[model samples]
Target: MSINWDLYNKRLNLHGSTQRDRLTKEFKIAKESKASSNPSCKTVKVNGIDKQVFIVAKSDKTKFSISPVNSSDTLQMGDKIFWKNADWLITELSLDDDVYVSGTIQQCNYTLPFQLNTSDIIQEPCIISDNQTTVGQDQNKIITVPDTLKHILIQYNSNTVQLQKGKRIFIDKQVENPSVYEVTKIDRITHMVGEHGLLELTCEEGQVTEKDRSDLLIADYVSVLPTPPVSDLCEITYSGFPEIKVGTSKTFTAVFKDESGNVLTDVMPIWNVIVPNGYESYVSFSEDGMKLIVTVASEFDLIGQTITIKLSNVDNPDGITLDVKVVSLF
Candidate 1:
């Protein structure tokens, strides 16, 4: 018996449209193709004569789709389709018919906020999910990272320590302690995203006991996207040295910021005073650390001798060290 794969794909596309049409709830897909670096998915009109790949719920409460797209690219594994307030990551695909392609997708339960810790901290929109070989058997979770993280995954597999630590992953929650996972296995698989790859890591849950499962309260991708703060101190802008009279006090302030000159908020500065010999007690910091007050004693009258007011931003440990030279106005 011959299979009518094209007809099967057409039916799948129609079913998704009837239940939830693409027009109202458009399925947005962003991937690089030969034409565009990040091309958005554009299917033929559902009423038109071309393939209109759409998502439909199956009998088992699972979602399925058939992307009979107008482009040369057929739907492949790992292609993310955002529909119905969820990220449906394509995990399986079958292209029996050249005109239409069908695939199976699963819900991305979590978003791994992958940070590329370079000069500028870049946050990768990495959507991921987890599975255990035996449900509730052990604390091991198979972390499935979609193909969008190909470059970051490559850095992860590097033999060099510096390169290996180029990227980091975190999942934070509103609770006291966020769930942590330690990587047990690291591997990759070929996936299509206009030609992207994937990362699959066997992560053992750090919070082993059932009572310590804070991941349950963890914020979703949308919730954590804006909240998780990443601040890298590019430079510190401080007030110029004020002329200090003998036995008087003067206050100075500094602002920490990133490469874009956007002031890094909620960050504190580590103030250090390098005075000549007996001038240690002269300098004192404000309660909130916003101001540094230096009371120059009358005996300290050396104009050339400088009090190195060095401050470091805690966000980036190798933070900027600035000097504040105090000149006495006799």
Candidate 2:
């Protein structure tokens, strides 16, 4: 047997009133409860702005209250609410589990700035994620111009529903010499309960006018490359091995070679090492992800223990392993 909950909605309208102006209004709140399942919305003052809050508790399946606002406000994606005086950001919205809502606790109410090209041709608002410039390491010479890549986020607007990949957008608010960008990636957010959607876009930073400030442009353009074929019977080659003595330091550059002697640089091999007790710092990888450094302390008690190393590739799960001796005196 199903239960029916009769809910009541009270709307208060104040007119020229003091704190103790009780029961002197021409309009009184309706005092009858009605059975309804349709979601309702109301605007509340939050941070000096009127924010729409939703209530969907009539059809709640959880039996218990998942959100404190469920009794008064309908739940929606990206809804902001306060609990115990702390602000919470609504990350997910669902009604399957009794009108569930989930999100992270925001330390404070914050607003993001918009960087958009405000022209009559395109008036939709968009924001840049971050901007960055490359260090001269790739060029190996004196760089004249800085290379940049921009990560852009464009919110889904009900007015313009035709936005897709490869669409060009403006970066600045100026129409005189607008900075344009071609969208590359579109990250879509979907929910099983609500119809709200958010789009995360990636763009290649385009030409900017010399008159504009350089600091306005941000993001790094990383080239997406194809992966190489998986290798069989891969071999792990490194330097300075056979016996790692205590109190000594050695560096090893490990590279995986295929059956045809071709180095598999695209296939990232997982490194797995096992060291005995007290020699935990015997092996480590370099910051550049190319070389491995091994430093064993002389005070290690387990002298004859074996150190095993395994390098694995995704396509070839059965990886190769190498064994080394742990020596105390040389």
Candidate 3:
């Protein structure tokens, strides 16, 4: 082949010009194409404050981005993106290439399984690992835990509004001793996603039973008390009274209940002790009005005295009365 340096140089220049023209045309076409359409702008309340953001999305996964029209509001991580029938948490953001946004899909129709340990009085930390496999399945299903999950975050739909952080909720897995869980944290900001926000719960260690597995799959979610207690119902109860010695002390616990006999888990009964006329110096009540302490002096007049310690509350007139006998061995 004959070597033509001048012709080779000219051909190289022409090819470079053609490639530049094609690149420019492709860029113009990409810029003209809409990333997403029919964008919806909404204001979500975060921390009792309103934040406005626009969501631009389509049914196709590739055709989704946040705030395509308006640049004022930007989508950040932890912001929930509701596209189609599924809920997705924004995990990545890209402003280049006509704005590419993507996130992992959180099943809207499924509730995360939480196991609780009820063997002890204090609840154990919630076990949310994805190691357990279901029946007929060789591999375990993956579950996503929020980055801010120091506690259990239960995402509730429409039927879980009554669930609050301080209220106790029932969890039944058909065990002999069913355990109740307390709501620990409630994410008020991301609550604007679907039906309601997410709830943080105190969970113990356990596995989901096969019987309740259907309920979890069907999105029954978790049932909570429709009406939670707000105030005290003014009912007090305690164990039987014991013999009062000269120098011994006894501790008692009073349980408060409501009109429907439901234990007042949030209320503390106000107690007032009315000791016998002469026995006032021997018997006294605690400062918080919950415990009754007794101390008999050596100079007490009667060793065998039948004293009536009236445990009453002015606010709640329906109180109990116990007769404690004071005995001293000389």
Candidate 4:
């Protein structure tokens, strides 16, 4: 018999899924939970200004309670949350097992200003904080930006998101010679069917040395972002469960790569699962079709059964087929 989860949701005063609508904040979250998500998010204004999230939880000094926020996004890492009159950065993303997308948030100190497609600097509302070490590294910080401007600080990758990772720009163009910062790192925050739009960036203050002065130009306020190199698909790597567990679905994934081991994110891979004539199996695929899942009813389906799955790409007719076996965990 299925356990009545509503009994537990009520004991917690969640009132079922209605808890997300009750005493929750409205956030501009992503529309998709997979790759190819949108990043160029336009802010939503309430009462002539952008919306802000306020936490009433007394859980800790900085940690917010597990209250739900209204948004279409998957609530993943690299997504910023405005809190405590300051913008706090989300270091961990929520999982499917989570009771609301709960995680830790540190205050942001700065914003990685952007000029989408060489336009004027799009002053991002919230802060992103400065980095000390490696580019695109995830670290824990107690940092924060002013809370008056509350919003999530989402960053997009320089590749599929159409921006340059190393592009340089001025925080303010009005100043005679404003400070320059270069985007040294980027992380994709939005998810449509796939990862897309506003990326998290790790920018370091840039210097204008005399040797570099001649290279500066008036027409080009910022360096043009470079497009990712088009590489031929060289190999495919398959990752899957060694054996199918009882009463559990197993997932298998394929990673397309080039000769240099760089992931080829542009390809569309398809999966095919086959079982023996007497066996019954249910199959599924991840949102981006990069993963395949297989599940059988019980030992009845396992009797005299052998399972196999193959990966292929329709676009790349030359792509090789990978055959992997799936045996019963029992």
Candidate 5:
């Protein structure tokens, strides 16, 4: 008899089951199948149970004879069997030596291993797992400002918070956040100061204004002062005679001015003069003395030598000074 070529061709062309369907069927079949029957497959037994060996091996009858692997031990039928590697449990056994070894079929209480997705895991505040309250101490928090800040203004409801000369605050105009400012100076009372009001605050050089203060909830009405117009007056001046020959006398003078061209007479001005490859010279004067006179030592050399004069006031207000370069020989 010739085989059915068409039927054989049809069977050969048929595709095997898909991975998903195959796995599903495999699990269903395994759950329905009974235990195996083999002496080697019988692993562990529970105490006070039937003296029987529960085997877990490939067999058609799926039955086993319960027997203790060691002769001295006493086991009873209907005992439990536990496998080491598979962690399988056996619920039934038989004591007859002729009976094939088999374990009672039971559903496994297997649990799927838990896995975490780092990308899906959110941070503390956003996740509910974090239940502790966050600490808000001053030492733990740091205030920062943008590099472009040039000045800052601090506004408050009342003058209760006095503004000092130096304090730091933060400001960010681009963001919809409240800018912070530390007190710089409370120069005058509200009624005495001009209409716009004043609350000078020391801040980054560029952070000087508050875009919004409606929600600031403060004591009294207050705000940061606008940037003052920079003065063009000379903050410092240095004057000195040109280079001196081996033995000569030199006179140096310096002048200080405020925002206005008017002279500043609050403190005496000091002068520092330096000669190339020579010792530094310092001179102090009374508030009335703006000029300095000094005699050049005879041992001083004039060749390839120059003098530099610098003038500064008390603590060098704003750390600004004026310098004068002298090269001509006297």
Candidate 6:
């Protein structure tokens, strides 16, 4: 059957209208983007051409035409926008085209661990020595003599009965030969009476008399008498101040005690007083004097006054006690 041109044209028009309606329906079904919830959104004027853009509701199905307004409202997907003013950072973007921009959002930053300079830290130096040890471990052992060998003497006999003076003798039992005895004294006989000649012998102790012969003997078993050991004879105890004003007397008592702490009474105590600028004075006492009085002259008027006093036994002299003190007379 032959088709009519006019009828075909009319049918074409109807189909075109139907197709347009269908496209419109499809565009309406497409999802639209929504505005961000950030409150910083504001309306600003866009200087460029006006354009219609589709904005989707939060449901994503509804579409709205966003026309450019004078003020930009939070630049939502549905809002009309013309121009952007300044460069603003975008903080959040929603899947539905919601944009959140921030002007005051801080930039990315980081902090490193704290460090100290050389001046801030302090270090102390220490002395370390392997040679340094405890006190008692380094002390010297004291020498002790057996009490049984404290006193011993030996005598020798010779054909020359007269002995010289000031000679020493050595006696020991371990040697095979007899030890030698030096002659310490000599006695000359001048006369012979009757049938016997007079004889005499002398030793270092004194002129050996006939009565002293009982104490002398010639012996095989003998040893030299050991010298008495030296010990701290006395200690001086202080009972006074070291410094005194000029023309003023400072009285201090010194107790003379033996090693056993017994007061030694028969000896005199000697003292030496020293002033600041090298002035020295000596003071001594009688056999019964234990306390000493020291007087200082007023010529030494200096700010840090210092005085030294030394005390000792006058007879023994080897043992000593020392004391020093600084005082202000001003």
Each candidate: RMSD to true structure?
16.6, 21.6, 16.0, 25.7, 31.0, 49.0
Off by over 4 Å in 1: 1-52, 69-73, 118-168, 190-197, 207-330
Per-residue error at 213 for model 1, in Å?
17
- The number of clashing residue pairs in each candidate reads 1, 13, 4, 25, 29, 19
Q: What lDDT tens digits, residue by residue, belong to model 4 across residues 256-312? A: 776566787777876666666654434333434676666655554554345666555
Q: lDDT of each prediction vs. the true structure?
A: 0.48, 0.48, 0.44, 0.47, 0.38, 0.35
Summing lDDT over every window of 10 consecutive residues in candidate 3, give the lowest-scoring window: 118-127
TM-score of 4: 0.32
Which tens-of-lDDT digit does each residue in 1-330 have in candidate 3? 899989877876652457666565554445335433323544443222455444555576543444423333334433444444444444334434333222222323323333232211222212132223234433565554433222443444332444455444334444454444445656555424443345434433233343333333211234443442423444233344455566655555555665567765554455555556766776654644555555555534646776554444444565665566667744
TM-score between model 5 and native: 0.24
Please tell me which predicted candidate would have the highest TM-score against the true structure.
Answer: 1
lDDT of 5 at 140: 72
Error of 2 at 309 (Å): 99
- Model 6 clashing-pair count: 19
Across residues 1-330, which tens digit of lDDT does each residue of candidate 2 receive? 654433211223243243333242221111112212324443443333554443344343321122332324344543444433444334444545322242222222322222233312333333355555545554577444544456644435443345556555446543455466667777665421235434556677566544334343321222234344443446655565566776765555557676567776776766677886666764443424655565666656746777777667677776767786768874
What are the TM-scores, per candidate, against the unseen true structure? 0.37, 0.29, 0.32, 0.32, 0.24, 0.25
**Ten residues in sequence with the least summed lDDT for candidate 2:** 26-35
1 or 4, greater by lDDT: 1
Name the runs in model 6 displaced over 4 angstroms. 1-233, 245-247, 278-288
Task: Report the C-alpha lDDT of model 1 over 1-330, residue by residue, as the tens digit.
Answer: 999999977976762545445332233222122213323243432212234454455665655554544334465555555554555566667756433466766655554443223223332223454452332423476554332222222212222122222122344544566655545555554443334334555454444344222444322122223322333444444345535555666676656766555776677777666777866666544534666776676555445566666666665555445455556565
Q: Candidate 4: lDDT of 253?
A: 65
